[model samples]
Structure formats: C-alpha cells, structure tokens
Target: MSYQDPAIHRYGQVIGLTIAAFVAADLLWLPFSNITVDSSNGVAVIIAGLIAGGYWLAGAVCSRMARRSRLSKVWGAIAAAFENIAIFLLAFIPMSVASCLFMYLASSTARPRLDAYLVDADKALGFDWPSALAYANSFPMAAAVLVFCYAALTWQIPIVVLWHACVNGRRRLLEFCAVLFASSVLTAITMAAVPVDGPYLYFKPAASLYDHFTNAGLSHATTVEALRSGPFIFLISKTVGITCFPSFHTTLGIVITYALRRTPFFFPVAIVNALMIVSTVPEGGHYLVDVIAGGLVAVAAIVGVRRLADHGRRIRTALLPSE
Candidate 1:
C-alpha cells in the first residue's frame, strides 16, 4: 500500500484554524482597540488567496499527468513534489503575515516594557550583549560576512523549500512545512507573553558603534518609529520587525538545520545555519536569552510536529476497518 502522507491534510487543518483565530481576534479587538484596518492588509489577503489558488491548480495538473501514464511514475512524483512546494509556499506567506500582525497586535495590548528584564536575564547568564557586539564589530570583514548570512533568511525559505521538494519528496517536504507552522505558532505565543524590541533598540547607543555595518536605510531608528506609532498592519509599507524575546531567526536556523539533517547537505548546511544562529546576536540585535528561547522553541516544535504526525497516522490506521 502506498504510505499516506498525513502532513498534507494536517497542514491544511492547522492553517485554517490558525487563520480563523487571527481573524476572530482581530474582529473582537478592533472595536475597543486603537488599531485600524489598512487596505494593505486586504491586499495581503487577496495575494494569499491567489497564491493558494495557484497551488491547487498546480496540484490538479500534476495529479492528472501522474494518472495518465503508466511509465511516468518518477516524473509524476517529481511534479507532485513541486505541487507540495507550492502548497508549502502558499501556506508560508499568509502564515508569516498573520503571525507578524498577531505579534504586533499583542505588543500593542501590553503597556509595560519587557526589554529590561530580558537584558538582565542575559547579563545574569554572563552573556554581555554589548561586549559581544563590540567584539563582533571590531572585525569589519567578519561582521560584513555575518550580515550577509543574516540577510540570507529572506531567500532561504523558498530555496530550501524548493530544494526539499525537488530532491527529497512529498513526505519530507510536508514534514518541514509542518515544523515551520508549529514554530510560527509558538513564536506568536512567546512574543505575546514578552514583547521586546530586541538588543538594538534596548542597547541603542552601544549598537550604534556598529552603525557602519548596518544597511544605509534600515536601522533601529525606523523600527522604533513604526512601533511607537501603532500596531503593525499585515502588508504595511516598511512595517517594523516587532518580534523579540525569542529570536525567530534563531528558530529558523534550527528548523532549517533539522530539516536538512540525514541528507548529504547536512554538514554544509549545519555550518551555515550555525553561523546564521550566532549572527543573530549582532546582525539581528537579539539578546542571548532570546536566541536560547528560539532554540528551545525549535526543539519543541520539531518534537510536537512529529508526535502530531504519528498520532494522525495511528488514528487513520484505526479507521481503516479490517484489512
């Protein structure tokens, strides 16, 4: 019997529930809160719908091709893998935008600041972020290299998704997407409980030492300004990064590394991801505790996703009624 991939449907169910919760929360909060709906958010929703439609269309085409030829199983599976990639990408875009909006909304609800506590926790652990930043900045070349790796997060997701889809197969690709979904959800939880602006803003003066390393237009200044204005809109132009406490960058590094494990790309990917995680401190202006939290979140997400997949399979088997 062909092994059933539960990750596919499991992904859909989880995503649907997540989006529903966010929409409900947004509606409930809109009346009493200072937050206002922006047209950009609507644009984001429409774009997400388009992407999802394309994903389904691709899957339909792939399925038709697969069933039409007896000797094309390999190619058919490959096409199906691309379909899987589409589903994942479609899921990722909306999930990311939703999570960002969720985090910002949560931040707006909280009146007190949490950055000082997080900074203190870092200091208590003997992780001096300032000294670390200074040391990193001392080496311009190294700092530049790390910054490049840090920026890789933007393109890494699609590239890794494509790589897994084309090379591994549907099951593995689904597994990766499942873990990502879990991580993104966990990120919202952690950020809401303790919203922070990261080390750059918390340590603005000290961070300015490395101002030369930062991109010209982007800096802590812009983030601070946007954040002070109000809650982030889904597709708001130049919306600031509101997540802190746990570094999503660190979480991403762990997830990617975990996804690539047991493959020929493991060692190389490991090194790159390791750099990416470490670079989070300086490049991302994240506190040490934040990075630790992100790593833990990644671990939990992987374990949780696996158990979910296993439970889904067991339930499916039980319902199969006598072989």
Candidate 2:
C-alpha cells in the first residue's frame, strides 16, 4: 500500500545499494590489475551506476506521486518492484563482465584441458543434421527463434518487470528473479564446461552464422583467450566468446518464456521467443545439438524454480496458518 514517507525509505535504499555495489565491485577488482586498469571496466561501472541511479530516482519520483495521489497500494508496490528490477537488470552488465573474468580464471587451472575434450566432441558431432521432423526443417521455424532471442534480451525482461510492478505481486517477481538467477547459473556452468570457440572459431570454411562468428571479435575461444590475457585484454577484445554448445541466448529466451507464461500476452511472446531460440542454430552459430541442450537446461531450470517456489509457499502457509 501507500506509505507516508515513501521517498525517504526507497531513496535511502537506492543510494545505499548503489554505494555498496560500487564498493563491492572495486574491492573485487583490486586483485585483478587487468580488470582494474581496463577503460571498458570503468565504463561498465559508470553505466551500471547511472542505470541504478536512474531507476532509483524514477522510483522515488513515482513513489512520491503515488503518495500524493493516494494510488492503490498494489500499483505503488508494482512500481517499486519494477524500479528494483530495473536496477537489478542493469546491474547485471557489470556482474556479467566480472563473471567472464572469473570464468577465465577458474578455467585456467584444469578447465582448458577439459574444454579441449568438449571441443573434440563438438567436432565429432558435425554441424549437418538431416531434417527428421518436417516442422524442424522449416525456414519460418528458424526465423521465429531469431526473433524470440532478440526480443527476450531486448524486450521480455522489461515487459515482465513492468508487469510485476503493475501487478505488485510477489509471486511473479520472485518467479522472475528465480528464472534469471537459474539461467545465469546454468549459463555460467555450461560456458565453463563446454567452452567451444563456436562454429566460427572451431569449424572451417565458416557456413551460415559461423562466418559471422569467425569475423566477429569474440567467438568462444576469443573469450577464453581474453581471460588468459587478463581482463583488460578481454575487455578490449569486444567480442563475446561464442560458446555454442549450450546457447545461453536460447536458454534465457526459454526461461523468459516460461517466466511470463502466466502473464497476459504471454503466449504470443512465448511463441516469438520459442522461434528465436530455434533460430539460434542459424543466427547464433549454434548446432541443432546445442539448441537441444540449451532447451533442456532451460526446462530443468524452470522446473527447479517452480518446485522451489512451491516449497517456499508451503512453508509460508504452514507458518502463517489461516489469516
């Protein structure tokens, strides 16, 4: 509902979180000279700060307005929640960059060798697969996946966040966060385990999107190499490594689709996202096998999150009893 001093509490939280995130980032960067020295890293920090600050400011303004207008508590909560979600999403940029650095460092020990094995397996699989299902062979199927992937990154999260804010419902917000967290964890693991140079770096004569990968600054191997070279080099490399085996791009799309399934307009959005995921094979330089694996991971993450939420609800119900 509407709080009397909304701006006071909310703005304080915003400022505190911003300062903490900055301090934490700086502290984390201290040991890594490359990351600390990299200009891109600095830019990333600034961008993250600005984004967080903007959302915080927006939320403060919205809260003040809501208080004055005596807006419904549900609407106010939705606004606040969205405000936080935007900040969180924006914060992901720096976090993701940091994660890549961490990924490289972790892989340096025994992961490189392990990755070599994965690469070999990917090569053995080959990219070519005959059309088994007629639907699978359609061009429209590929186009749909491409659109879905693009929208998920560009649109879905924002839409979901807004919906959560408008609905002011904890369940949807928690679901959204769970999906994102699960996807991120799964992606990090997959990238670590199956770090391929993608079709471009690993395969020759670059067919389809593989050519784009070859020409792009960051294929999968480039990311690993960037890690080896240090954060500065990695930052400068510009090209995100193309780990094709389990396309997080596709996986995230699936996660978003599932997360928004209960919301209005979700079905159409989900369909678009599903298509975009399918398109990853051609548009994202992934193999059919990679898409399948990514899909399965998304499914597992969704199921796990649902079960976790259910368990949490049960616990809450038991504790609260009937109100």
Off by over 4 Å in 2: 1-43, 70-82, 90-94, 104-152, 206-241, 321-323
- lDDT per residue for candidate 1 within 1-323, as digits (tens), equals 12356655665566666666665766676566555657876786677778767866876777787788775677576666657767676766666666666665666664676889988898899999888888888888898888877877777666667777776456777678778878878888888788676776667655366764664213544654555576544455445665666888889988987887787777776787788888888778788999999999999989987887778888888888896
Tens digit of lDDT per residue, candidate 2, span 75-176?
Answer: 467557757666556645555555555444434433343334544555587635222112333455444445445545667777777776566543455455
- C-alpha TM-scores of all predictions: 0.85, 0.67
lDDT of each: 0.72, 0.56
User: lDDT (0-100) at residue 33 of candidate 1?
Assistant: 55
Q: Which 10 residues in a row give candidate 2 its minimum summed lDDT?
A: 209-218
Q: Whose TM-score is greatest here? A: 1
Q: Point to the candidate with the largest lDDT.
A: 1
How much RMSD separates candidate 2 from the native structure?
A: 6.6
